[model samples]
Target: MASNVVVDQDSCISCGLCVNNLPNVFRFDDSGKAECFDPSGATEEMIQSDAIDICPVACIHWQ
Candidate 1:
């Protein structure tokens, strides 16, 4: 299955956990919220899973 990671901006707290965990794939926006920096690049599947795992609101999803 193809895989990708996304963060729900509405639910995101911009804690930077995802940024820290997946720096190459994630970046902080002007508002400090995590944004997809490389949606089409190679991503660590486990790290995406971890992002979903660590999200306080459970808003992260794999697509």
Candidate 2:
């Protein structure tokens, strides 16, 4: 199954956890907020789940 991940920039604290956890799927924008650069890059569900779980501000979510 394909996953739809989204980061709420307003709620994101720029912790970089998601990027560190899944660089292929998440990245930091010019403003330093987390953004989904390539949702399709997340091939494994576990990695996606880990990203969501590791988000301190709970800004990452599935759309």
Candidate 3:
């Protein structure tokens, strides 16, 4: 199944953890907030889960 990934902009700290680790799935917008640019960019659930887990601000979510 495809994961519906999302990044809570308000809760993001602009840490770049997600962007640096998973550049295809996450990125920084003009505001510097973490954004889920492409949910399907991650080929495995574990990768997506790792991104969510590594987010210091807990802004990344899979719905």
TM per candidate comes to 0.74, 0.86, 0.85
Q: lDDT by residue for model 3 over 15-43, one digit each (tens)? A: 88888888888889999898888888776
| Stronger candidate by TM-score (1 vs 3) | 3
In the order shown, the candidates' Cα RMSDs to the true structure are 2.1, 1.5, 1.5
Q: Candidate order by lDDT, highest to lowest?
A: 2, 3, 1
Clash pairs of candidate 2?
none
Relative to the true structure, how large is the alpha-carbon lDDT of every model?
A: 0.74, 0.84, 0.81
* Model 2: per-residue Cα lDDT over 1-63, one tens digit each: 676888999999998888987888888999999899888876657555768877888888888
Model 2 ranges off by over 4 Å: none
| Candidate that would win on lDDT | 2
Instruction: Rank candidates, TM-score, best first.
Output: 2, 3, 1
Error of 2 at 44 (Å): 4.8
Model 3, residue 24: what's the lDDT?
Answer: 86
* Model 1 stretches astray by more than 4 angstroms: 40-44
What's the true lDDT of residue 17 in model 2? 85
Clashing pairs in 1: none
lDDT of 1 at 10: 87
Off by over 4 Å in 3: none
TM-score, structure 1 vs. true = 0.74
